[model samples]
Target chain A: MTDSLQRKRVVITGLSVVSPLGNNIADLIQQVFGGVSGIKLLDAPFVDQLDCKIAAQAQFNPADHFSKHTYSMLDRASQMALYTSIEAIKNAGLILDDAVKPRMGIYLGTGMGGANSLEEGYVRLYRDGASRLKPFTVLMSMNNAAASAIALEHQITGPNQTFSTACSSSAVAIGEAARLIRHGYADVMLAGGTEALLTYGSIKAWEALRTLAEEDVDDLGASCKPFSANRTGLVLGEGAAMLLLESFEHAEARGATIYAEIVGYGTANDSNHITQPSVNGQASTMQAALADAGLSPNDIQYINAHGTGTQLNDITETNAVKKVFNGHAYKLSMSSTKSMHGHLMGAAGALETIITTLAVNTNMLPPTINLIRPDTECDLDYVPNVSKTLPNLEYAMSNSFAFGGTGATLILKKVK
Target chain B: MTDHSVSSDKVLDIDEISKVLAQMIASKMELDIDTIKADSNLKELGLDSLDTFDLIFNAEDYFKIKVPNDQININTLQDVTALVHRLIVAQKQ
Candidate 1:
């Protein structure tokens, strides 16, 4: 768009995560690749009263990572985002010297920011009848808090933005960040999503919607059964994942290790309904991404689905894939890592994108765990509770379809 | 919250109040208690204006004394302690 300069290519140079599955890249890869489940019994005080007592909670201690005063000032969401961003910078071996600092930016996504702090403040006000609250309550509770915290910590002074599209928040965030690099708005970007909404009030609200999975009678961790006939609903989860993205030329000039090239990104919304996903919306978005990547339906070897383990989502997404890929839909491998990690809400897309990137780079397919009895309507490979190696895997797509009918698709190509 | 007695009836001398103030400042700033000299400027010790407000709030809760916004013109740990002590004495009277 600017001066018809050759469209730049965006590539992922580094990745970091703090999720229910694992905290670092190695552990995450091991867990996902081994088809290990991260879903566990809820560890909150109010779990006993709630019907849905399972969640995928990230195991993190802020005191171990942040200075006492610094951690006190941040919400849980900001803490995860800041930690992952720093780790991603180090992973990329990036030097934030003067020349690069000004051109760098931060883009983040979150469904709910500072849920803990907001809930605590409300409890103090209404329950305890306290007149005063914490000084940083507003700063921590704002939706842009995580992005601002990341920007402040790294002194990234360009194009800081935050996107909130419910569950698809991070996917949209990563997609827009790549667009920024591709269009020459910024040379480098830290893009990702974070969510920490596992509070009593948040869960009770979600439970009221009747869209949460009931705990399995036998195995508590097997509650979230995506694409299964007996699936109840989604299991709420919390975590954060950040990726260091740089223009191809910028990364190459620095001799950075490229994980994958972000060839295409597509985002669309269904104007028909707010909560129910539209097959037309998902199909069109995937088609748009393929066209942008200059690839055909047959070219995509894998899809990281936005399968939320709900009755509506799994069936709708299956139909959407069939509509887009047709017969090739049967050929391509598809899986929902949410089956194991639960639904990370905002961070799902970022984490799944990273997983897709790894699949392209390493030629391995992550599996959809806990799918005991696949629904006939949702018929697909789904990788089926077992990870497998796929030789010559070159291109993979990650999908995130959120509430409010927002759908995002990202196409990643192997660096080779 | 600071671990001081809740009731205003609990009396403390200037030295005890100063010790308590120094401990609170050190904990809030994540500094070593021994390094928190009474003569050191709080700003120089990395406690910003917002941090001062937070410290006052904690003191109010711990010492059971109200700190008026205008009455706070503290620079050193000693000033904070003397102010809190005076507020406690006023509350008692």
Candidate 2:
């Protein structure tokens, strides 16, 4: 490629997450290392009415973190996004002034934007027989509410966008944010995904889908066992994770702590089935990401699998990995942090990408916590049950496969 | 049409209503209750459009009265107190 056509190097300058594991990156990383599963029996009134009684709920109180006016204006998802964004920006040490405000962008993802607000509105309108709804209901319940709120809070005037592609939403957000930076559209981007669909309506909707894990498990932590032979289904989760991505030159000029370099992003659609995952699509996307980074499959030492704990998804993802990595599949370490944190849906990829980046930076692989019995088909080394340390890890990939057959992969290399 | 019930003839207490309204506004604005004054302009309270909306909704819930959408233009705390008294009287009638 010509010098002018060369893509700019994008590096992760900061990371933050409001996960069930914890509210900040340090606590979340500690939980991941300790194999602490955040899944628990939900305490909502609708829990008795649903098939699944468990979820990985974020430990956040909007009243504690935001002003009443701010919390009223924000849905749960937006609140989490704003909290994570503030932490990430502060951690990145990027002061937003008049000069940089216009160039800073926000790319966020949410599977069900403001579902809590929508549910509350509906309850008030129907159940309570209230003729008038809250005036901010429409604003809070909109899919772009989180993104817009983040932009308004941070004064980011650049391309502000939100992606709602089911579980792959945040991964796509990160990928698109990197593209914006690589193409010289922006220097700093706040990118990630957040979801707060723990409301009655949200849980009931998932119950109707019948993909939630059965509620009879003795241990709630082991309910979501991705790639396990006895795995039942996915446990719903909610949280927000944000990453501050900046051009290499921008980060270095500011002397920011660079976590890892995001070298490649690849996304593809199965186009075959909406709910069913396709190995072909997954494999192709990983291959495409490897190609984008100009690295072979053997160069990657670890993969943060989408691993939704559903039988079909786990098996299909394993087959895809084997096809793409060939002989290197056995040597590579792969884990699904979702097994510990449940599945954050839209925010899954962002949180997992943070874990993947940390793995590359620290050379310590997070374990797939609940994998007591592995599926015969999924024979790859999953770094099961306990965290592992690798020496001189070079590159890692984070994968996100969604319900609509959308697949996204990002490649991050250890900073030299 | 009017009913000559004792409750209908009773005038709603303005001071109590003002206190309730100020508390709601203070809570919404995330300010101390003592800092909010009844004479302060609702706009000067640093409440944006959304915050104003929430304030009205909360007021309706507190008084068990329906606040009209057009009444959102209430400027001062006195104006809001008057509106609430009017709404409560109208609701009772």
Candidate 3:
């Protein structure tokens, strides 16, 4: 409320995660630290049909565990999405006590929105007829369905949108939401991503793209081998993650538990290719985010990488990290959460943000699971296969690179 | 059971309808002239789910028929032709 042009300060007050490794935040932190792997073999109909059967599907179905809403309008993906959003709002100390609900906003991201639901609808249509399709099919299948569902569920009348930039979707969503709160668009915001494309059609689409691990279909214990020489393809995953953001003053006034402050966010596109990643864009995006936070590269102690375990991504990201961090790259602790949780695509950024946030909150860094051998080019300290406790650090950065050469980076600092 | 074709005064012709349906999709999607076949699968012809929906939405506008969601999954170009033809005849009746 002080300046009309300058954005206000933003801080994270609430957090929730539903990943392949775990359902709740506590379980996720434990499994991630314990070197537990979530990637597994698939027996579903589509897996059997695909050349690749490996995926990091959620260990437990949210519907089986969480309460089912009466609307039933949401596809399963949006269901987990809204569930995490509500949980974050409640946990964030913003409990809609009349005054808080009116000032809040929600934003979500997804690489593929309701793909499973649309696929199912198509199957029914092909087998049956026009009358067989569900009444809510179109509404549930929109790319913004997750955000829309959360808005309806929480009754959020504030700004609502969905980010869909392939993999960097959630990172951009989180950054934009932070910007909104900081710019006084709202006092608080709920931001993150949800993606559940674990279906035959989606897997087939991946297979067609030739970005899937064809041979490892039966290996239930396999994890994404980021920066590994043998890394050939990325693993698909499903889940949702949400964070509750509020202005620092607003949070302090409300006596909320502040986890960390979102200091900077940067986004850039390579304009090079539709699917391939560019090292220059990655470097510039990281630099831009650090600059936005008004911190030097030396300020970042940990980096949660956009390590998809694909050969191209690993090598490309390694070059970018080395260039950006210089010699200090080797000194910085960096790891890929995809190693254990698999690639949640759009949700990866949101989930990785939470992972970095938790690291700051708990003062412990999770391990890079299944890295038996380091890739020759990627020599950065990956904190291989074992978690380590660390001293409190002021700044950490998370990187997200999506298809279409879109890149996003977020830098966060402890709130003191 | 009934020789409706002979007595069909308000019915749409299936063959003519198929030709027009093919042209509509091929024109809108900018089909690879050589690839577009009357019997070829619509998906194989590069008509993705979104494109298919777009075709249906346009058809709904032109025919003034509320196309149901379940019937939108027409697999082949022939399937689309048959659907349009049947729906037209039904609407006329």
Candidate 4:
């Protein structure tokens, strides 16, 4: 906190997504806005063993984008992360020469890094009784594999770190990356999260926790219905999202197109329960973010809630919103894009933050689809079932409450 | 490790090992088999340390011989082939 370390404004210049709904930003916008649910019955060999057979799977093939020699050392999660980062850099029109590369860094998050690779290795060792495994297994299965791959590819020498706080992993990553820019630690950072834990092992573990949504009897796609009276639980998903964050001054100097300004970020631990959401923690986190932004609750127009379609989470989050926003919660529009994209675990916050930024930038709020029954306890204008245009939409928020009792809130302001 | 030895009569010579090594390198580097000379430097042929390790691992599986860690200083396909030939010959004894 010296003169050179004075607070600076950080703005998102580029965004890319490898989501269940779509791969590119254009397709993502179309699918999310059109209320398309990406959840479907899984196509894996072990799907028959699990009670919940559906998930929101990204339509991606690593072989299509990488060479055998290159992708052979990457996990499914790293593949999505590297691919998304490339698209984000291209979208930002960033020229990462040697000088800029040193100042650039990456901060990524993942809940289950390299799950597919690890599970495959386990099968080889245990099930197949294989005495030896490939050398690439360890490299591919590490938690920081995605971030390391991006840095090695781009020759970024700055602080490359990875966060793994379960569902709030990417939220913490994005917020911390913004903090670094605000405090002059780095000029630019590629911040985001990726998760590809829809493997057979991962699904079985989630099923053991009894948190996965049952497949809808009539339509598998509607398995996840956040804030609805008939909501079951969160549908597992696999995806990646990356945002290029830089100082506002730097963006202005380069004439970059700004998506939205990251005005505030707040994170808090519940210290109450390991897997249950806390109302006080969620409320205080939102209030802390509002205070950090130097704005009251009434100034925010939209919120992309961490609505995971679970009964407890929905009611707890609704009560948290009411506690923090007070009467303003009724006036502002809120929705859970997870109803369409399913719960992406570690990648959820970054994806929802992008959705929130888009809502603020385009003046169009995406809806929480499949919310047909309307749970009375969760009383709020959820922008249910369809997208809407909100004139003069200025600021929006995205909240991520993780299973480990961590709550993270990020506020985005429309770039004027 | 389990005995991965091939039949005693099928012991490969240096030339045969060189041919198989060339094919592995060619397939891995996506180059024509004719383009990968036995004497060409592996680095010059666009094979880094990781690529070299991968090629060696595949060669070990194919020839059923363990290329010792000390033999990892191979500079060319000929060198790799010679090392594999030695390992296979040792395995026969």
Q: For candidate 4, lDDT tens digit of each residue in A1-416?
A: 32544789999999999999899999998988888999998988888888889999999998899886677789999999999999999989988987678778899989989999999999989999976677788989999999999998888998899999899999989999998888888888999999999988889899998888888889888889999999989999999999999989878888999999999999998877898888998998898889888898999999999999999999999999999989999999999999999999999999999888888888999999988899999999999999999989999999999988878899999998
lDDT of 3 by residue, A301-324 (tens): 999899888888888888999999
The candidate that achieves the highest DockQ relative to the unseen native structure: 1
Each prediction's Cα lDDT score?
Answer: 0.90, 0.89, 0.81, 0.90
Better of 3 and 4 by TM-score: 4
Span of 10 residues, lowest total lDDT, candidate 1 chain B: B1-10
User: What digit string (tens of lDDT, one per residue) describes model 4 on residues B6-93?
Assistant: 5667888788778878888877777888998879899998998878888888887778777778779988888898888888888888
Q: Is the docking of candidate 4 incorrect, acceptable, medium or high quality?
A: acceptable
Off by over 4 Å in 3: A1-5, A60-71, A127-132, A214-219, B1-93
Taking the tens digit of each residue's C-alpha lDDT, what string does model 1 give over A1-416? 44436779999999999999899999999999999888889999888998888999999999989998888989999999999999999989999988898889998989998898999999989999988887788988999999998988988898999999999999999999999999888999999999999999999999998999988979888888999999999999999999999999999999999999999999999776878888999898898889878899999999999999999999989999999999999999999999889988889999999899888888999999898887999889999989999998999999999888888899999987
Task: For candidate 4, list the clashing residue pairs, or say none.
Answer: none
Specify the poorest-scoring 10-residue window by lDDT in model 4 chain A. A1-10
Which ranking of candidates, highest DockQ first? 1, 2, 4, 3
Candidate 1 vs candidate 3: which has greater lDDT? 1
Compute the lDDT of residue A28 as modeled in candidate 2: 87
Judged by whole-model lDDT over C-alpha atoms, candidate 1 comes out at 0.90
Per-residue accuracy of model 2 over A1-416 as CA lDDT, tens digit each? 21437789999999999998999888988999789999999978777877788999998999898877778789999999999999999999998998788888999988999999999999999999988888888999999999999888888899999998999999999999998999888889999999999988888888888788875457887888888898888999999999999999889998999999999899999886879989899998898889888999999999999998888999999999999999999999999899889899999999999999889988999999888887999999999999999988989999999988888999999998
Relative to the real complex, the DockQ score for model 4 comes to: 0.46
Residue A110, model 2: lDDT of 89
Score residue A140 of candidate 3 by CA lDDT.
82
Kindly report the docking quality category of candidate 1: medium
The DockQ scores of all candidates, in the order shown, are 0.70, 0.67, 0.02, 0.46
